[model samples]
Target: MTASPTLFTRIIAREIPSDIVYEDENYIAIRDIAPKAPVHLLVIPKNVSARLDEITDAEEMGRLWLTAVKVARQHAADYRLLINSGEKGGQVVFHTHIHILAGWENGPDSDT
Candidate 1:
């Protein structure tokens, strides 16, 4: 049987609409539908690992972080890189993703 598509997969396919911020051979970044800060972007791998634990190599993880950092710097704002690993980790979407939040006017400072 064919696997079902995740929300991010559909977005990447352009089956659903999204504000794409960046795109490359292996990844795509989009504006988060729910804003947690003045600036928020969701960076996801096109490879579609359902969760961090499912990732087989460091390459994908490395690429995701590199992209996130590039995006954060481009925005010229201090940023938070968040990855909610599993259900207990508060990950709403099954597809693994990085939440890039910046331009924090008010909020507790990130521990990192």
Candidate 2:
């Protein structure tokens, strides 16, 4: 059976273009094609792991998490990070990725 297209795979293959801000051997930081916040970027790993829970290797998971932190700092000094796991968790793309959102306030009166 054909597999679903992963977010990382689409970025790597250039099937879907992104506003790439940073890139390295291990990861790539790009602006979200559909941004929810004023400043939204997607930090994706080079490795093709489908979801966060699917990653069994501790070292690999650690590396990806670290990469997310690094990318987040670069984009926003104070950013909100999110990683949706499954459908229940709002994981639209099967591929594991960290969403860095900032440049917006989320106070009590702030609109979500």
Candidate 3:
């Protein structure tokens, strides 16, 4: 049986509305509905993975980080990249993604 579509996947299909920041063929970056920082964005891969650990391809992983970095640089001079691996690692959404937090005058605002 096919797994149900994830929230990110739904957003990718535009089924759910989101404040999209950046989007390309393989990734889409959107503003978090509940932002923890002054600037909080989630860079999600078009290809879905339940968790970061679930992805084993080196090139794919590198590309994901590259996409996140590209989006972060577009939004802020200074930013952070974060990934919550699994439920125990504080991941609420199963889709593998990188959080780009910025817009802080000082350094990182949260331990994350």
Candidate 4:
């Protein structure tokens, strides 16, 4: 039987609406629904790897980093690259993804 799709999979397929930042053959970058920083983007591979360790030596791995860097450069600002590998690692989505936090800003409940 075919495996079920993850949230990121649906997003990549355009089944669920997401603010798509960039996309190509192997990867797609989109704005995070729940923004952790002022500019939070999720760069994900189209190929389902589940987590970082799953595809360490894959060619797509390098592409993933390139894609993230490309997106980060667009902002021309300080940014942090994060990856939540497993469940306890704060990875709500099992699909491997790179989190681009471009800097702190007033969050929803912040005293701005």
Candidate 5:
């Protein structure tokens, strides 16, 4: 049988070392190692699920999305939320995650 992919799996397997900010039974919040903004962070669900569309149930989706928002607010007074889907959408990791970017104004020339 194929194995289910989880956000924590990569971290646990040491495939990637995230600047972890928070962790618990259900979720993990980590700083974006290659950040685009000053306060770029990623909030990931601990459970195994490949992508946002792969989420089989509604409750799980709610929990994951809400957790991302909560963690983002903790770091900045205000922030922008993002989630990349397929490869074309710029999702590098197979695991599902929400990116919380803030602490800098996104001007037209701001690429980072």
Candidate 6:
């Protein structure tokens, strides 16, 4: 883990305010500050991992996806789950997180 806390970590620590939708001991769900879809949420793990691929444990990976689904279902009937694996994969945060995109009327739009 980095010596300094990541943005998500600060939010989880309550050092930074966020629109948290759901939270548990190991995970947290929050609305994206800059939303792409009408209902854009982020499902993040409390434990720090630079990238999703960094987590190699089968159960841990499964639980992350499961928690993301739980959070998504709580907000929308249909949703898309996304994980940007690395900087080359379009991940900016450097923290492992799942993006929950949904709440579209006529499917997702480029501009929302």
lDDT of 3 by residue, 1-112 (tens): 9889999999999999999999999999999999988889999999999999888999999999999999999998988899998899999989999999888776775454
Better of 2 and 5 by TM-score: 2
lDDT of 2 by residue, 1-112 (tens): 9677776787877898778887888788888878888888888887767778888999988888788778888766777788999899999988888898887666323675
- Cand. 4 Cα-lDDT: 0.86
TM-score versus the correct structure, for each prediction:
0.89, 0.84, 0.94, 0.87, 0.82, 0.94
- Model 5 agreement with the true structure over 1-112: per-residue lDDT tens digits: 9786454687845587778887778988888888888898888887766778999899999998888888987898878889998899998888888999888766424764
Ranked candidates, highest TM-score first:
3, 6, 1, 4, 2, 5
Cα lDDT computed for each candidate against the true fold: 0.86, 0.81, 0.92, 0.86, 0.81, 0.93
lDDT per residue (tens digit) for residues 51-101 in model 6 = 988899999999999999999999999899999988889999988999999
Better of 5 and 6 by lDDT: 6
Q: Model 4: per-residue lDDT, tens digit, 1-112? A: 9778999999988899999888889889999988877788999999998899999676668888888999888863667889998899888899999999875555334532
> Could you tell which candidate, 1 or 2, scores higher by lDDT?
1
User: Which digits, one per residue and each the tens of the lDDT, describe model 1 over residues 1-112?
Assistant: 9669999999999999999988989889999999877788998989888898898788867878899898778874577889999999999999989999887666436432
Checking candidate 5 for backbone clashes, the offending pairs are 36-112
Ranking according to lDDT, highest score first: 6, 3, 1, 4, 5, 2
Better of 2 and 6 by TM-score: 6
| Residue 12 of model 5, lDDT score | 48
Clashing pairs in 2: none
TM-score, prediction 6: 0.94
> What value of lDDT does candidate 5 attain over all alpha carbons?
0.81
